[model samples]
Target: MSTPQPPTHQQAAPAPNWQAAPGTSYVSPIPITRTHLGHALASEWTKIKSVRSTMWTLGVFLLLVVGVGLLVAVNTTTEDYTEVPYTIPAFFGLILGQICLITLGVLVVSSEYGTGMIRTTFTASPQRYRVLTAKLIIFFVVAFAVSAFAIGLVGLFTSSLHDGESGTPWGRSVLMGALYVSLLGVLALAVGSMLRHSAGAITTMLGVVLVPAILPAFLMLSDSMRTIGEKMMEYNAPNALARIFELDTDSGTGGSQLALLAGVTAAAIAGAYALLEKRDV
Candidate 1:
């Protein structure tokens, strides 16, 4: 029969400290606002733009594409072609441009791995697929910007030079060219990711992209070798891309051929992503 007395404020005891030591720093929690993917995209964009290779590759593609078109157009004379009034600047430069484009793609991913930055990239963006998509988005945008410049210049200059025959449709040609270049870069990105070594990726891509063209030339020296060379050139990426650019040409193949080539490259890219997931960071 008695009411409990109110406890005094001074009676409460202090809780024991659980931290390792007085001088030790506490681990910080991940921020709620952290946008790892956004950070990765921005960093990737900066890295892509900052590299000397990117600048050189873009500059060279611009010159080879626009400059060559201008040169060919200026050099065209009345005697050049009577049957075809307008000339599509010989696409020989595309051959070289592909190499540059592929290099740009390869460097996008391989350079990171080469410099031991892949670990950091993976750590920052653990969602591997998101990282791949981010790189693709950034690379494609850059490719489009540069491709527009090159293809637009080609169309503009070619229109000026030719007097008689109908010229290529600027809109279609430009769009196709941009898509082709962007896809080539994407293909290179896949190769780079799988190989993770610049030399190996570059060499392999060169073989996949260029050997087809060269084989036909080198093998032509011998009659028996001609068939071998011709077969190799049949499914080449450059040839398939050329089909996309000039729809009128026989293209030695059809839309399905292009789809097949793209499909193979896409499969390769998917395989690279799978490897990325399985392998150590």
Candidate 2:
């Protein structure tokens, strides 16, 4: 009884409340928001603008498109524009400038693969198609805008120099030509995505554009291939641009050329999407 009662254990102090007060939920200091295509577009825009290759390629493109166009315009007279739109001179420059765009397009996707940055890109976004869509949209917009500006500037300069040449409408032809070139860049982009190599994709696109123009000449040597050669010339990129610029009326209508390019580009894009989805980084 009285002598040896065990010392009672001291009650443990209540644990401190580390969470937010009652009825109030803890909020993280960092803000969280859902990502979307707009975010991907912004990211792509930043990447494209910050890269040295973008500046270099685009600078050369402008020089070729505008410089050569102005030079051609200066050398020609009003008579030279009589049978073609004022924009036709721009077509000659674009024939070279388009290579710049194709190169840029290939670099856009392939450079990331080369640097192993695509894994980070996919990790950040998780949706491959969204990233591809952003690339296509940004590249197409930039390519089309730059192309149109250069071509249009040359057209206006030529028109002003000539003063009153009767030819096909400059506005429509200039826009169509710009669109066609942009599509070529897009096709190049798809090829880059598929090949995952800048040099290879660029070479492939160069062949796609230039080979059709040149191979048809060789093909014409054989009677069996003469008709095929004519068709190739009619549907080739150079001839398409020529038709659009009214420089070549025998190569088929500009609309048909655009349709052919559009269909081919669509197929290429589909293939790119499939490969991207199925392949591992």
Candidate 3:
């Protein structure tokens, strides 16, 4: 009974999720570092390379390009190229291969939304704009590289096989062909961001890239619309790419088409950025 026992009290431990500061959430296990666009770029590169969709789409694209290109090369006569130029054969393959790039581009953004992985991506990197920018850069670079490779292969094979087929405009064909594909990819990414649904985005991009090719054919005697339709065909991706190859048109003025595509892509991206900022993940 001697000494009076003091009342004992248990104190509660600080919870992990307790807000330490205004607007500050719980700390993540990832090391705190100054984050930048480079980090987001690396993340985007990893995602694009690791996905099977990228592999399958790009693989089929290469297969179509190489296979059709080689066949065209073997069949082409020196006379056939004298008037048409050597790199024209690549147009046949690239016309189809472009669809693959467009599909892959849509998948890059839309697939994430479809699978709900975009939530995780946004969570890890809170800067939404950076993530979208990273994706656009990574996708455009990859698309350009792959398309250039295919176009380069076709151009080289056509040149070598024909022997002394000078004045082929190799520079314009390879460079512009790659640019055309990359531009289309960027557009598709923008559309994907806008739509956020895989099928809808894919369908919309398909119309953008493909419908123009056929629209001119179907437009009959609408006077004002006929002129617009002809312009659509003139500026359509396939025709523009063909112009790069110096086929179907002697001007080979792909520069104009490239400029137009660049303008459209820039506008679409601006719209996408606006939408991204105003919307929730």
lDDT of 1: 0.72
Q: All candidates' lDDT scores?
A: 0.72, 0.90, 0.86
lDDT of 2 by residue, 47-135 (tens): 98899999998899889988999999899898887777888778888899999999999999999999999999999999999999999
lDDT, residue 40, model 3: 98
Q: Rank the candidate models, highest TM-score first.
A: 2, 3, 1
Question: Model 3 lDDT vs. the true structure?
Answer: 0.86
Clashing residue pairs in candidate 1 (N, C-alpha, C atoms within 3 angstroms): 85-165
Give the deviation of candidate 1 from the true structure as CA RMSD: 7.4
Highest lDDT among the candidates is held by which one?
2
lDDT of 1 by residue, 153-206 (tens): 765666666554453444665665567667777888888888889999989888
lDDT of 3 at 133: 99
Candidate 3, residues 98-181, lDDT tens digits: the string is 889889989999999988999999998999999999999999999999998988888788888876565555767788888998
Q: Over 4 Å off in model 3, which ranges?
A: 1-31, 83-85
Query: Which 10-residue window in model 3 sums to the lowest lDDT?
Result: 15-24
Measured against the true structure, the TM-scores of the candidates, in listed sequence, are 0.77, 0.88, 0.87
Model 1 weakest 10-residue run by lDDT = 81-90
1 or 3: which has the higher TM-score? Answer: 3
